[model samples]
Target chain A: MQYQATVTIEQKAGMLDPEGTTAKRALGHLGYEVSSVKTAKLYEIVLEAESADIAQQKVDEMCQKLIANPIVHNYTIELKELN
Target chain B: MKIAIIQFGGTNCDLDVLHVLKDVLGLDAETVWYKQEDLTGFDGVVVPGGFSYGDYLRAGAIAARTPIMDSVKKLAAEGKPVLGICNGFQVLTEARLLEGALTTNEYPKFRCHWTNLRVEAVDTPFTSKFKKGELIRMPIAHMEGKFYAEEKTLAELDEKEQVVFRYVDGNGKVMDSANPNGSLENIAGIVNTSRNILGLMPHPERASESILGSDDGLRVFESMADYITENF
Candidate 1:
């Protein structure tokens, strides 16, 4: 079976988010009243697995190995079986 | 003595490093591709600056996982000197060869300019030629050069005296204005716990020659050479 996985990587809370701060500051310069903005990277991957459980496990391994840095980033993984 | 300058696809500073090592320091240096799995016969290794893989997925993250890093790690474990500059510094952090991460600059800019640094410790092989508290100037060109580490990590590094260089004013005082990228504690360079590996945001190769402004960076290479002669 083919499974599609999406991983969202985000900076940990309390860590400095320069990209978010810059976006918020830029919005303020444009007269918007946004308090803040946070940025993240989303990765969509398709792979072969026996079941959704296996797919999820694979995606989790991917996240732990490369997609996220435990020191600065947190990641969430979503998996779906493809027909 | 032979040294290897690990070259990734987007590495632009490999030649600069070769020039400094071969021409300036009189050492035999060769550029090794990232795919080469073995790093035997090299007494030292340098991960030169440049956007590896176009800085994709985060600067240095992908490059750090390449096969060559395994050999680099093995060599580092053997107590061989390894130096990483600029983007190479990012790779070192991503490889977990060094602690901390280099995040985006506080102002989120790709700053390229000469900055003054104070030598914090001289006991390490990388800075043995530098006098304690010596101030020198070097160029830094990177967007994500702000070094960030947890409080505990910072404390441990401080306690171990592993910090090698700190951004400072010409007068050697670490002022906020002198910090180009808002690195924690103005740290510009640091050594591993073993002190054999060094990673720094500054480009020592760019300053090895007198005509390129200041020749202060030469001492770093000189120190490494002296270390190889005495220890290896």
Candidate 2:
């Protein structure tokens, strides 16, 4: 079986988001009804795991070692199993 | 007079920093790799600038956890002087040796140029060579230099005179537009609450030589020498 994990990283609140600000302003003028928006990096990984527990452990290691910087970006991981 | 400069893999400024300390200031300094666990008998420790771990997850994130930082933190806690420049500043903040965090520049570009800095306090060992309100020129090169801290923490730093340097204009006035990184209160450098650790975005070593334009940075290094002589 193969599992897919996705990780998203976002800037903390009150931290300036230059990229988000620019994007939000542009989206507003385009009539997208975007009030506030923040930018984040996304990573998706596919790996083989016998069980969900093992898959989660590998995903956690990936987040800690490479996917996200715990110091600034907080990450949320989503996992889906494919049989 | 032996100074230890921590050498992380991506630390580009370690050699230049050593040159400034040895050749410019005539001090004995050596580079210590990040894996070393001990930093004994060193007068001071410097964390030079570079994108450690290729700035992989975040600037200074990976390097902060290196074994060398444990000893650096201990030295800083003991009131020994530690200076972090550019990416080194980010490393210090990540290691919790200093307060606040650095985000990307407001311009969203990798800014590299000389900028004006006003010395906000001369009370700490880091800025003793300069008088309060003196304006100095230094080069800043970084994509993430905007410093952010909680409002209460910022207020406390102001009250304690720990906000050491701020970005300014040629007229010696601090203006938001002149703030290259949009740092809180235009902060460019600061000392820890204990006043032993200093972190700043500007490259003082780059300005130590007259040929580089201004030698104002020599004062910063010289000030450290003065502080060491006076105290130790």
Candidate 3:
């Protein structure tokens, strides 16, 4: 089966995010009442796997090993079966 | 005194370190390509700074996973002194050889200037020549140089005396004004628990000679060289 894994990585809470801070400041300038903003990287990985469960495991390992830095970033993996 | 300077794609400071090691310090230094598997011929390893893999994904992510880093890891495991500078430091953290990660500065600017770093520990082979509380000046040029670790790990690092250098002012006072990147506890560099691996943002090779401003950074290289000879 073919699966598409969408991986979202972002800076962990309590850690400063410069880009998010900048965006929030900019939103304030635009007259929007924004309390906070956070930035994240979303990766859509398409791969072949035996099942959705296997795909989820593979994507999880990928996030741990390479896609996301475990020290400062949190990641979420969503798998969708493809034709 | 042969040292292996690992060079990955986009490693611009490899030759700068080479010049410091081979010409300035007069040590046998060579730039090893990122594909090389064996580093048995070298006594120490220096991971010079630059945007390896064009800073793809993260500053040092790609380079840390390259083949040569395994060889560098082997050398490090044998109790050899391994020093990482700037992007090299990023590589080390990404490789899990060192604790903490380098991220964008608090101000999110590419900082290029001189930094006054106080030696917090002298136990590491890289800082054996410097006195504790002594300040050294070195130039740092990078976009992402903020050192980040979880609170628990930060406390452990402090407990283990692994914090080697902290950013300080000209008067040697630790304050927020002196912290260029807003690192935790004003840390500019750190050594691992074993004290054999040291990582920092400053370009020590760029400050090796009097002509390059201060010779303060030279002591780091000198100390590493001295450590290799005495122990191995």
Query: Chain A TM-score for each candidate, in the given order?
Result: 0.93, 0.85, 0.96
Residue B63, model 1: lDDT of 95
Rate residue A38 of model 1 by lDDT.
92
Fraction of native contacts under 8 Å reproduced by each candidate: 0.73, 0.53, 0.93
What lDDT would each prediction earn against the true structure? 0.93, 0.88, 0.92
Model 1 lDDT at residue A15:
80
- Per-candidate TM-scores read 0.97, 0.86, 0.98
Give the higher-DockQ candidate: 2 or 3: 3
Question: What are the RMSDs of all candidates, in order?
Answer: 1.1, 3.3, 1.0
What is the docking quality class of candidate 3? Answer: high
**In model 2, what lDDT does residue B106 have?**
79
**Shift of residue A83 alpha carbon in model 2, Å:** 7.4
In model 3, the clashing pairs are none
Q: Residue pairs in steric clash, candidate 2? A: none
Compare the candidates by lDDT and give the number of the best one. Answer: 1
Error of 3 at A6 (Å): 0.6
Interface RMSD of 1: 0.9
Residue-level lDDT of model 1, residues B1-232, one tens digit each, is 7889999999999999999999888898899998888998998999999999998888999999999999999999999999999999999999999999999898888999999999999998789888999989999999999999999999999999999999999899999999999999999999999999999999999999999998999888888888877877
Error of 3 at A48 (Å): 0.2
For candidate 2, write residues B1-113 as lDDT tens digits.
Answer: 77899989899999999999999888989999998889988878889999888987789989988888999988777677899999999999888888888888978999999
For model 3 the TM-score comes to 0.98
lDDT of 3 by residue, B1-232 (tens): 7999999989999999999988888888899998877898899999999999999999999999988888888888899999999999999999999999998999999999999989999988998899999988999999889988988999999999999989999999999999998788998899888899999998988899999998888899999999999988
